[model samples]
Target: MYAFVSVSHPDEIKDRKRQGKLRQHAIRNGIQRSKADRAKKDGVFVPVEMEGKTTVATKRPTNTVALTKAPSVSLMDPFDTLCGCPERLRSLMRHPSAKQAGEPIFCVEDSGKPFFQGMETIFRGALTDPSLFHALSLVLSLAANNNLPNVEILQHRGEILNGIRVNIKGLKGAPQVSTLTAMLLLIGYEYRIDGADCNTISMHIQGVQTMMKLCKERNVALIDEVQRALFWQDLLSCLMAGTPRFLSHRDFSDFKNPIGIDQSQQWQVPKGLEESMMHWPPECAIVLEDLNALCWIVDSECNPDQEVLETFPIDNTQANLESRLMDLLRECRNNPAEPDPWYEACILAAYICTYKLSTGIWMGCYIPEICIGQIFQVIAKIPVDAQYKPAPALLQWVLFVCGGMTERKNIRQQVATLIRERYPDPTQDPEQEWETLRTTLKSFIWCERTMEKRIFIFWNEVYPELHTVDSSRNKMLVV
Candidate 1:
């Protein structure tokens, strides 16, 4: 049944290229010194001032071949070559027609996770550069079929690395943008190839970071797509790495509101949500804030721009939030006394929210299912009839999201029954009933990346016929 419906984001991941000349010259692609002219150290960066602006310059290799006019860095460098793969193999990487989401070639199960939307084609080859073509092939193959032999995977990986190394071996400035994409693709490949067996993606991630640094410090501009890909990889990998995020200091996630959130007047919570949860920790609050912003961005249905990246750089925003939750979950379990059911439930709810918008291979492959299963055990500790004194709104959000994420039919029915028990459709204001539910969802976190049809199934059951006229819009099921 393809349990979770995979969605490609509404916006296409277009090439982001900005051309500007370095202070010394007025070229559209910016200030790039010819390799032969780069007389300083081969890999060391030296500051160079031009037109009153200071930019870094790299020392070049001893033997350099200088072109009469340096070519501009294009994300799609179609003429680039050096991938030694035979034509038979190269043919496999080429798709004659564009495949829609959920097709055999467009597999994105855990790859899309909760909210990693609009990224279906990132691993698909840019088809411009040969090295990148190989990298994309490996990632595409692994994503399409996780059970491919390790030996085959390693051979393809080696070829990708060798091709990239040779292509950028003597470049004076940053590696070509397609090479940057390939590097990002390799990180994605390693992550998929090795679940938690090892952390091979770490070195690959650091390598791309180095390439990005070369571009920025030297006034070399990379395509916007590559930078965005870097942030996404940083976000997913950090959860398992347990190390501080690679893009730690580069966060810009703080925007109270951006655009496209249609709700105006929020419905009054049936209970005092804020007053009751005075005991909640600061970390919980931060995660909720991050989730709320995510809800807005997802609801906006727009491509994630600089504002969204800065505000919700998963590397820091989600990684730190998950780390804090881990600590809290551990402390709660290790306490000398019985854990606070309310506190435990709250964090578990927030923990579930972590996957509501994004899902990926964390410490455990497909950890979303495992973590959501544990949620029931915690909820069991609380009596069914008893109200969560901390906040009922929080509980409802948890039940609905947890219900959508759970694949088990009986468990989902149990969740739907629980939600109905609290807010029955017997109310005189049935329209208001549905409105109130969406209001609460928005107040916390909700996005289409969430299991849409599943959530709507629960909603239709809980409050029959309350679905809006446009409810069928954006149906997520693939089969």
Candidate 2:
């Protein structure tokens, strides 16, 4: 069943938009150079002079401050004393749709793992643009109203806003504005704040408009390069299970074209799973096996239940596609560039495991458990002699599957065996190494892209309803 029964709608909270708008107004009025156009180079920050006050004279400006280098930064500055955004944010808190005393909310603790925490580093470092900041501010404000801001917020506000009037708090470097804005932009405006408003359709549209207004007022791009990056991040989070750390820095590349399948597909599957299969769970292996079986059944006389393909009953499927996807990987094992056409067909068949039986649900139960044993097994079983070259795509699939799964000892062994079996020497042709590297990279990218697709569908379509249903049932049980 879907999980979001008790989830509150943000819009359901009375005047949340009004509160948010007011705060946005306050931010517009209070913030200096909210626009990227006004941003000074990192080293060039002059004290924002007040009308009558002098720059707080501390020790002479250190000559050592690297003017050419970016300024030192924090992900979430707990030292900020500025409470400028809180009052307006608190106004949003009073919204009836905001979290009530017993309503269910996203598990902040579940999200607190260090792997997730690293996202802050990505925010502070690679993602220092205005769209990101606006997104961050919006999410944080929502977070503030839903639950108490982490104690860190209070501590930082105390420090940053020290001796300053409450009204002027948002002016000084408000990290929340930067951090949360990035997150919202990353997750995008489509996500509904649980418990806010249940009836309004197209939360993404509302979110985008709200975010765009903030961006326009601040003169940030509603959709820009950084926005694309943030979108990618959000997509990855939604589809792929576990923390962000498993997703590496090299995974994101400006040069790579994002897989441009339908937005619906984007919602359904994550990218880069061609390489991520290493992390799949044992259950995924079973699912992958089933998918291989399904392909066999489709080609043969077995009359499988048509409903097994339906997306909604995924968790209850007789031959869970997720398990089949894992088995497909195991069967695909690492062969070099040359294998028989039938073997190639076997590899292509593996992708079907990712497909829904009927409509459009991406059952990815195999990704987290995928390891090298299965991957190598597929390769070792498929024979390769001089007469036949494996489907070129097989290498890509191998790398992609490995990327999603975790690294087990078997994976390393398979890698070694595949390389030795395929290109036995360091002196192997330069062209071949290049091909290998390129294929590997492609697989990894595909894995990441697949992950992104899955996340969007889960959060936007699945989780909200599921959580609501779950919450409703729980409440009923309690009563």
Candidate 3:
């Protein structure tokens, strides 16, 4: 079941063509320079003046292309051709169908709809750009062929990295939105494909954040629907890494709310405890948004001042959220009738995030083991179709959280089985694949051990597996 249910329509070709013409007109009138033109002028050519003579100087070329009347023939690496060089990738990306397709190649698991609105805009622009397309295509290929053998995976990984380096080295002066998108894709590749080190991913996140700020300063509106989705994903990554987020609430201010319960006054729950439990307040989305925003503030780059801390006391905030959650759960229990499992699952997911935020701020002082177990139980009761329908991205994160927190052997096995069933890898052994995923989750948690000295010390006692010198050590599986 996809977490989000909103379907996206393809952008009108004429509209994009009109925008392209207007942009060209602006460039002709000196309103802006084409990114390619700017790239060419920016340090690509150096003027040399000697004895009143001027000559254009060029650096050693990465590849050779004969200058002739006929189409220049460039000799390139075989791997480059096989992997889809930037130019070739760009052409493929700009195909009219690419815009119509809406979804990025790497996000195929999220078929039937674009992850969010404004993705068309980002994809449309990305397809026509060489560097961005190369990065985007690399990520897409990785996601599509995740089950490839280790040898093939390594080969592809190397080629993609080289392609990124060659293209990015050519980008000079100010960073463009396309460049930022490319960087975001690279980070996604590291997280999803490579199982990259936390420090490496953190550095890339920081780089993207810097690029975003640069775009804003230049009046470049880069944060569209696609970017908002990426930003949210990165925020989740930050939480796992125990690092502050680069993209904050202000960056995604224009983001649309995820689909949820009806907020209209005309919408009402039936008059029974079981019925009410099966329904969520329209305000549920608002509360989730608030929780996300509060999480951003709590994990902001700067430490919270004493005054700020006092105003939004972590303990009180968590208690209130938990209380509200319990009230809803209690209503269902009192009625002796089962609530809609799906609705109950959604509430449990929301609480998981709420608790996660609190744990991050307080260094896991309040373990939500009970809530975590409830999430698994409710999820187990939910139909497979329902689990994937509402919002896949959100659902994925919630499942990741559930996987991370649970120590119960049966629950861990269940989570692993569910993941394999949902996202099968035909090339890999299912058991081994799920075990690797579990290890990855534990590694992520282990990396965050230094968020607070006391917390680290406390976790060392509670989670003895953390005592190992190798920070990459995985926690012991709970029997």
Candidate 4:
């Protein structure tokens, strides 16, 4: 009778109702309280409700630290703090001895708006990322201390390499843009540190190629102006180093026109005269691409078969490209009384590349004296201040071509002095290389034979390592 009369207590009913409400609230919010919450509720410490906020309090009257909500955390990047002050960045970029130093072959214009924008983005990201910042700082310090003795230079170089290693290791998990930019900075750093040696630089470029492939797979488009500039820089680096291009044909397929050529097919110089040489005709890119491809073919360990050879028109292709380049050069030369030194230098570089491709020698059928003289004339007319504004690689290559071809002792000495004064790096030798090249040129001059034929004979007899073609093959004359 007692069991039958038993009924649920009012407090138990209220407790059940509150439990159901909590379940419903958790379901609605898609958040379930963990076992820890239950354990906390069961402990001596009880949660006190004040207004709508719940704060925990201990039953034991022991002294306890009051807990208040922490201030909201700021997620702003540290680099952003420095972004508003560009003067600091400009100071960092400007060479300390820019005024005292004679016109450098290349000088970065820190005050330029475009440079500021580009650097702002780079510096912001670098500052936000510790590894990147370290690597960049080390490289900048190395540049600043370039005049230091070999021992100190080597120490900084090792630090930079360590920083690069750390950054590269972190790249595996980094965001796409971050990885790409970091790799670019590393590539630039290597170029500066080691000059044109492709040994290390190619590794960074290969990494970029892998990243680009990943971006492609993810359907990420990298067609912005900054990316385009980076792409061009990578392309030019590969061309100069004689390495295979990182960007495949498909990489550029998205471009309506690959080289930005219009319907007219006329060469368009950039609007700013200062940038004309910096921005070569899109055609130059195409030609450089072809040249790079040819270099790969020539340097490959496995020789291509007739079918593979036919796939790319490497034979006599250089002559055709060189002809087109010469035509463009003539057009530029005819435009005005004062020729653009940068443009002229670029055209001359194209000529040198094509000539070297067609015939395995620095000088082609073109008269060395005439070509050398023209380069010097154009260089003399260029304003000293403006002369330093062009890219060092372009100017260095121009000087290299001129130095390699010049038969005059005085002119050769002048080019050597220029190289020593402007770029003292041994790897970027217009001096040491000139010594070897001068002997070769003199041998050809004495034999009254073109380098095309004489190079094969010289290599077959004296230097087999420098030979690219078979000594028995007469087909090398196709160019």
| Each candidate structure's count of clashing pairs | 12, 121, 12, 0
Question: Per-residue lDDT of 1-479 in model 4, one digit per residue for the tens?
Answer: 01122237766545766667666766755533566566776665655544435444434454556586443333323335422233433343465532211111112343411121233455434444443443333344445655232554355346545655665666554344544654565565454443457767777676666656666666664424335435544544443343444543234433322222223443333222224434556665555444444444444422333322334444244434444555556556667865567777666655654454433211133234445656777777778777446555556556655554433557666776776677543342433443454453332111111223433332222223333434354344323
Q: For candidate 3, give the lDDT.
A: 0.46
Reference-based TM-score of each model: 0.48, 0.23, 0.35, 0.35
lDDT of 4: 0.46
**Judged by lDDT against the true structure, how good is candidate 1?**
0.53
Off by over 4 Å in 2: 1-210, 221-225, 234-479
Strongest candidate by lDDT: 1
Task: Encode model 3's per-residue lDDT on 299-328: one tens digit a residue.
Answer: 553243433344445544544444344444
lDDT ranking from best to worst?
A: 1, 3, 4, 2
Clashes of 1: 12
RMSD of 4: 23.6
Better of 2 and 4 by lDDT: 4
Number of the top-ranking candidate, with TM-score as the measure: 1
Residue pairs whose backbone atoms clash in candidate 4 = none
Model 4: CA > 4 A from native = 1-92, 96-120, 145-176, 193-196, 215-230, 248-250, 253-347, 350-479
Model 4 CA lDDT for position 230: 52
* Model 4 poorest ten-residue lDDT run: 98-107
